[model samples]
Target: MARYVKISSLGPAPCVIEAGGSAEEAVERMIAHWKRMLGFVLPDKPDLIVMPEACDRPSKAHYPKEERLEYYRVRGNRIRDYFASVAAEHGCYIVYPTHMQAEDGSWRNTAQFIDRQGKLMGAYHKNHLVPAEYDANGILYGKDAPIFECDFGRVAAAICFDLNFDELRLQYVRAKPDLIVFPSMYHGALMQNYWAYSCRSHFVGAVAGLPSSVLNPLGETVAQSTNYYPYITATVNMDCAVLHIDENGRQFAAIKRKYGPKVKIHDPGLLGSVLISSEADDLSVRDIIAEYGLEPLDDYFNRSLAHRCAPGHMEP
Candidate 1:
């Protein structure tokens, strides 16, 4: 087995339902749009796919504030079902970010995750809602940060404006999931990279009207959607580990020499870092790290900090 996971992200090419259109028409349009975008990814055969926030409907940029607020309350379930059906057909994990009505009849910004078998894994509500989400949509904020367990690795999610706050970021740092699916209306390339590097996790962003990208733990963009096409896919080896290149260069080489075709190393040569993964199904980078006595870069830095001493007063 490759033990490698492929991720796909879609930047919204929206299908707007005209105001006053029949609800059936809206459902039809939503399903067709999702199918079209998802079909573009079947050829690539990604293990997971993410679509931008509110990709089911057009932006409220043209709708009056009041009408936009009430829109999702009536149609949220229908839109969600259309997405869920598509996820079932694809047989891959899908992050379908959209507006959802909570039990109290309150609307929430939620990223709903459907597992490979088309089961609803759970929904991660947007903990930090943008001002408009509250003032215009009267959206209620979520209180919990949930991390879902998956076959490849643990998966987590954060909504558009949720990226701006440290609350969610700190939670992710503590939880330390292998992957974070971020669905956003706004494009914040730098903040996304910050979250990825800080949490030591791979991040895939589905941004509306902009390029969607897959970023590695090193904050390097490994794949991105182009303007010509709204989606992109990349395969990531989850059996990888991050280590300090300067300190472990010799050990890394030795592992490569020993493992040969069983391991692959990806060094960007820019951050004194490298991503090393196992190729054979029975083995993983963990085995190599254990053998070489190589410590994770974070642990190495923490240990180094303990040895930090004030500079000698020769210059002082």
Candidate 2:
């Protein structure tokens, strides 16, 4: 079963700092940069738009490293307001990543979720911080991996450095979000697909200075940005059941024939990773499986748990 959702990723180089500006000036510059990027997004209408990590002020090239955090903190709320307003105007969810001070007065790398109504849903702080973030800039590492509930599905966030740590990944595996919104300045290649497949969730990576990508449960690159485009819009079906190879093959053609275009069967050409979805708004994958006497891939494997037998003893 596939739950279809439209999503977009912006992969432009994050905003740059202007030379010799007060905190207020710097903040405005960053806001202007964000607004420009927002304009570039096509009106093709995505349910959610994920901008790159540290989008509010991605780079501090012109300012001293010591001055960066304070400069960002001074106008953080303004940045928040700008995106919230945009989300409301467009009637879409926005993942606005920036540097802000938490309740404890510690600066954290965070991604805030702004709802379609222009309200703040919540925030996900970067659980893993780089040495420069903590040791140099004195930023705080987030304490927990939190999931945000959305109209589309359960959503989670992982900032730039968070992708490198297995600790955060394991937590996500346990919690299991329907989609992982990753906004990163660092372009992590295979790590993105690994996380998507490992957590069995859809992944959207809005990486600065690199191609943003969308990866599916099978670790396949479904859609991505390009050198010329620098951004991507994709439609993903989250309501889905992955069926492993078993007796399901016999039912594949029959099911396709019966449902015709109403049901979609996506074989990733990985031998056993077949994905199924329904186009009818009222129909679900479970309904189809039950109707046609089909076995879901997970249920099929779980049934085998009864044996706990075939291991190294099996023939090649």
Candidate 3:
């Protein structure tokens, strides 16, 4: 069972708005800018599209704090609605990141999940915020890490500053979502690969003015946007697992001999762990593991821990 999902990450620089422009004009310009960016990937027919954090905010505009708040009030959910329409039209999931005012009169730095039907599935608010967000701005910190279930797989999100905190990362590690979508103003660099490997999930990052990338469970870059191109699309198979090579070397060879080209055993060199994915239509990674009696990397580590902590083996 190969669950292949095509994803596109757009990393265009933030759209610019005039300092004295009306909110209505500003919203129109933002939409137009995004529309042009979307034109690059919609032709690829991606299953999901991810944009950068604070995507609707203007780049170089210098508006007073009060005026900016007023602009957001007037702009409202119009830009979100436009994105929803595009999602429905293209029949793809979208991660729309922005600053939104809540019903309680508090604002949140949010990444909203828009389903293929032009409906909002859920949102992951920024769990970790910088002091400036709380001090200069009135944005409240998000309290929970929620996983959204899409047609393809379970999804989670992390905003710009949220990547630095272990509190949010630990939650995602325990839950183990299939994919983590990161929409950020700042690139997390090695942290992106670390998060993907730690959680054993695929990572897609859309960072403004930087390279947007798609990495596999092995933390290997499958696709990336470059300076010449601001957008990139890559397809990933969700039906995969990671296993230690120490005990599974023979089993890996046997699987390859049996399944041949239908299975992929990817070794990222010195890690001593390999990512196994199924390419056949009839068998899944779980089926192959069960058939071959392979131990997952995490399970092996946990079992070793239990053995070390046994009553007879425990040290005084």
Best of the candidates, TM-score: 3
Error of 2 at 77 (Å): 0.6
Model with the higher lDDT, candidate 1 or 3? 3
In candidate 1, what are the lDDT values of residues 189-214, reduced to their tens digit? Answer: 69999998888899999998899999
Residue-level lDDT of model 3, residues 1-316, one tens digit each, is 8999999999998886767778777778888999999999999999999999989888745655655676788889998999999999999999999999999999899999999999999898899998889887889999989999999999999998888999889899889999999999889999999999988999999999999999998888999999999899999999999899978888877888899989999999999999999998999999999999999998998999999999989879
Instruction: List where candidate 2 sits over 4 angstroms from the true fold.
Output: 301-306, 309-316
| Candidate 2 structure quality by residue, lDDT tens digits, 1-316 | 4467889899888577765578888887878877777677747688899988877774666666656756866885888898889889889999988878767777888898999998999999898888888887678878877799999899989998788999999998778798999999897888998898778789999998898999887668999898897888899988776777578878888888888888888888855767787887778888988887888665676777744555754457
Comparing 2 with 3 on TM-score, the higher-scoring candidate is: 3
RMSD of candidate 1 to the true fold? 2.7
lDDT of each: 0.80, 0.83, 0.91
TM-score for each prediction?
0.91, 0.90, 0.97
Give candidate 1's total backbone clashes: 0
Query: Which one wins on lDDT?
Result: 3
lDDT of 3 at 213: 97
Error of 1 at 57 (Å): 3.0
